[model samples]
Structures are given as structure tokens and as C-alpha cells.
Target: MSSNRVTPTEAWQATASRAADCALFFDFDGVLSPITDDPEASQPVPEVLEALDALSRLVRRVAIVSARPVDFLRARFGTLSEVDLFGLYGLERSHGKGETVTEPAALPWVPVVEEVASEARTALGDKAYVEFKRLSVALHWRKTPEHAAEIESWAHAEAERRGLKVQLGRKVIELKPPVDRDKGFVISEAVLSVGCAWYFGDDVSDIKAFDALRARTAVEPGFLGVCVAVASSDETGQEVSDAADFTIESPVAVGTFLADAVKILQANAAS
Candidate 1:
């Protein structure tokens, strides 16, 4: 583990000290699951799921915040009822087996998003993989790196014409409704009553959540927020690590870290 602030052991100890008042937030891809060219094939490591399950019992709340849809997340995390799933960057959220609650402002844009997805597929013509989520669409150029710029340009133009919002990711550009929802907003609201929180992520978009933690720690006395970055190679990875309070190597490392966390939290509770 690498950190500029408190050491990893200290961070774990702080979280353990307030286990019941601390919530943990995680980004699915590159944090729990390894990033894959085929998004559907991405699945969290089995041990990581186990670690999260153990951590869930010790924390106030544990949530997986991702750019993917709720259904996808649920399919993998269905067995872990204590873990909340926030999908589409907080456009939709489901607590355990509960019904998914979508942001009210984004409802009307479903049809518009559908139209954009159709247009994107037709225009891109397999040069890019177009993923059509109900409230958003993502154009992925991971398989065809040559069309990266073109796909990004098309996505931006579509977002502008449709009055949607554009979110950039690794080899992907997503267009969602113009609603004011994101990981930062989600974390800020969830941690309102909590004493401490930690957010783990690997992508640049996760920076917003890190900033939210900083914002909370700045104003809220005695509140502790730790930002953990899952290390990567690209520019986005570098930016994320720079904003993080600490860095871990990969999803596998995340699994080990969470397991270690569970041990400390359990020990602290027993003491």
C-alpha cells in the first residue's frame, strides 16, 4: 500500500474504531472486478465478494457504485443482501433485494436515451460497441482502438443534440440524462449520518467521490474519509491515484486489503 497521509494500518484502525458509524463505498470495475473489454463478462473476484460480505456486517453500510446498470450488479451480488448497489453513477440504486429507485428527474429521458442508442448503433456500424442501458448509452471502442476519437466525438455530439450528459471512461464514452446524479452526490448523501467513510475506485470518474469525502471531512468535525485508488497504467489511473489518499495494486489487492480489514474490525469489536 502507498499513501501520503495516514498509513494503511492507521486507516484500517480508524475505520475499525467507528465500525458501526462508518460506510464503505466501492467502484465495481477495476476495484472489485477486473476491467474487461466485454463489460458483461466482468465479475468480481470470489474472495473479494467474501471479504465484502464479512465487512458488511461490521460497517454502517457497504455500497457498490458503478457505471453499469443495477441488474448487472445485482446478478453478481444478489447473494450478498447487505451490500447496496448503486448503478449508472447513482442514476439508480437498490438496497439489497429492494426495488431499484431511479432518480425522478431522469425518468422522462428514457425514450430520448433509447433513440440516441439506436442512432449510435446505426451511425457507428459496429466500429464501436454500443451498450444501451435504459436511461443511458455507452459507446465503447476498446476492441477497435482506431475509432476511439471518432466514437468520442460522435458520443459528445449526440449528448449535445439530445441534451444528455457525457461521461468519459476507459475506452468508453457514456451519454446519460441531464440529471444531477453522480458518485459524489451519492456518497455525500449516504454518509450524512456516518462518522467515517472510505471510497475505493480505479477510474477518473471516481475522483468526484474522493472530492466528496474531502468536502465532508473539511466541514464535518470528527468525520474521517479515506480515498483509495486501485493502481493502473493509463492517464486516468494516474489522475485517480494522485487524488487518492492511498493506492493499492489491483482488484486482487483489493480483496486482500478487505480481508485484512475484516480481521482488524473483528478484533477491534471483540476488544
Candidate 2:
């Protein structure tokens, strides 16, 4: 926290030393796979898949937290005994090999989310696409950047009207049910208990997860929490980079970092 940013190698080395109590968390888009305009086309790099397969052997926990639906994530990564999937920003979760669980509190808001999704589709018309999920509705303007501001304003108005929370991400605006959960809550309450936690993320919403780790470290100063921002040197991701303890330029670098983590943990085990 004192220094600006540590090199990826330093993070990997430190993680290796704390392997017994280490947990790795990742954000899917732009962290595991390259950000694509066609979200359906996004796929994890082979190196990332290999690294995760290896980490399953080394770590106590590996959690992928994302705004994607749990079903979509399950289809992409399959079920792993050591991996937990926190989807819809933790509104929905799937434990290793278990069925996806929706928070009971979030269920009542399903109709509300559907209504908003309908409004988004009508308002944005052809300029944007509405992504309907269990507890949230997202209006994505990735393919229509010129309509970004208009779509965002409408999404915000709808969220405000419905007493929903607005989640801002890259070229997307989401209306989430007014739940007390987020990436931060999920990490603190459900995932990260006894570990030197490492989280890699690439969007604005990921700051809350980083904040959760920082709060824990503040109470127990010996706690090692590494926040890795996967972002380009571009201005768009500066906020994410600034909030993180370390930075990796792209998803490719993220794959390399994870692979390095696997090797380091494997080496430590052999020793």
C-alpha cells in the first residue's frame, strides 16, 4: 500500500511463500479473457485455463467473481472442486459442483429487473442491447459507443425510479436489485476467510472488492492482500490501476501472471 505498484514477479513470489493460506480471485471479462464487443464470443485464453487447472491443485480456494450469469460461467469453465463462482456480482453464486444459489432476498426483485430490462430495450431501441439476468438488468453500449451517454442516463433514471442500484462498468450500465451484496461483501462474507488474498480485476466495480481486502488488512496488518489491475496504459482504466497494488497490461499478461503463480506454488510444494 505504501508503494505505487509492485512488479508481477514480486506478487508471484510473495504469493508462493504464502501458498498454504493463499486464495486467488479473478474477474472474468478483461481479466481472464480479452474484452470483446460480442460478449458471447469472449473466451478464456488457453494459458488461463491451464493456470486455473493447476491452481486447483495448489490453492485452498479459487473464486471467479463476475457480472456474468452463473449458467454462462458454468458453461465456460465447468465445475471444479476448488473453484467457486460468484456471478451477477454476487447476487447469484455456485459452489464447487453445486447448483447455483440465488440469494433469497434477491428473488423478490426479479420482476422489477425484468421490467427495467424491457424499458431499456424500448428506450435504447437498436442502439443498445439489454442483458437480463436473475437479479439485474444491464444495458450495454459496447457496439454503439456514440449512444453511451444516452443509454447510461436512461439506465440511471430507471434505477433511481425503481430504487435499484446502478452498476457502472466499461460501456455498460446495470440495474441491480437493492441487495446488501457486492463483490466486497461476497469476498468478505463468503470467500476470503483465511488467506493471503490475490484479486485480479479490470473494471470500476472491482474497486469494492479491493476495498474489502484493504479493510481486512487494516484490522490485521499482517494480512497480505494483493490487488492486481488488468488494464492498459490507456486513460479509461486509470482508476482501476490506481486502486490496485499491482498492474498487468492485458488479459494476456493476466494469463502469464496466473501461470507464474502456478509454477511458484508448484515449486514451493516440491521443495
For each candidate, the alpha-carbon lDDT, in order, equals 0.90, 0.82
Off by over 4 Å in 2: 1-6, 190-192, 232-236
Model 1 stretches astray by more than 4 angstroms: 232-236
lDDT of 1 by residue, 1-271 (tens): 1275589889999778889999999999889988888989999988899999999999999999999999999999999999999999999999988899998999999999999989988999989999999999999998999999999998888888889999998989999998999998999898888999999998889999999999988898689899999974353457898899888888898899999999999999999
Q: lDDT, candidate 1, residue 96?
A: 85
Residue 121 CA displacement from its true place in model 2, Å: 1.4
C-alpha-based local distance difference test score of model 2: 0.82
Candidate 1 clashing pairs? Answer: none
Clash count, one per candidate: 0, 0
**lDDT: which candidate is best?**
1
The lDDT of model 1 is 0.90
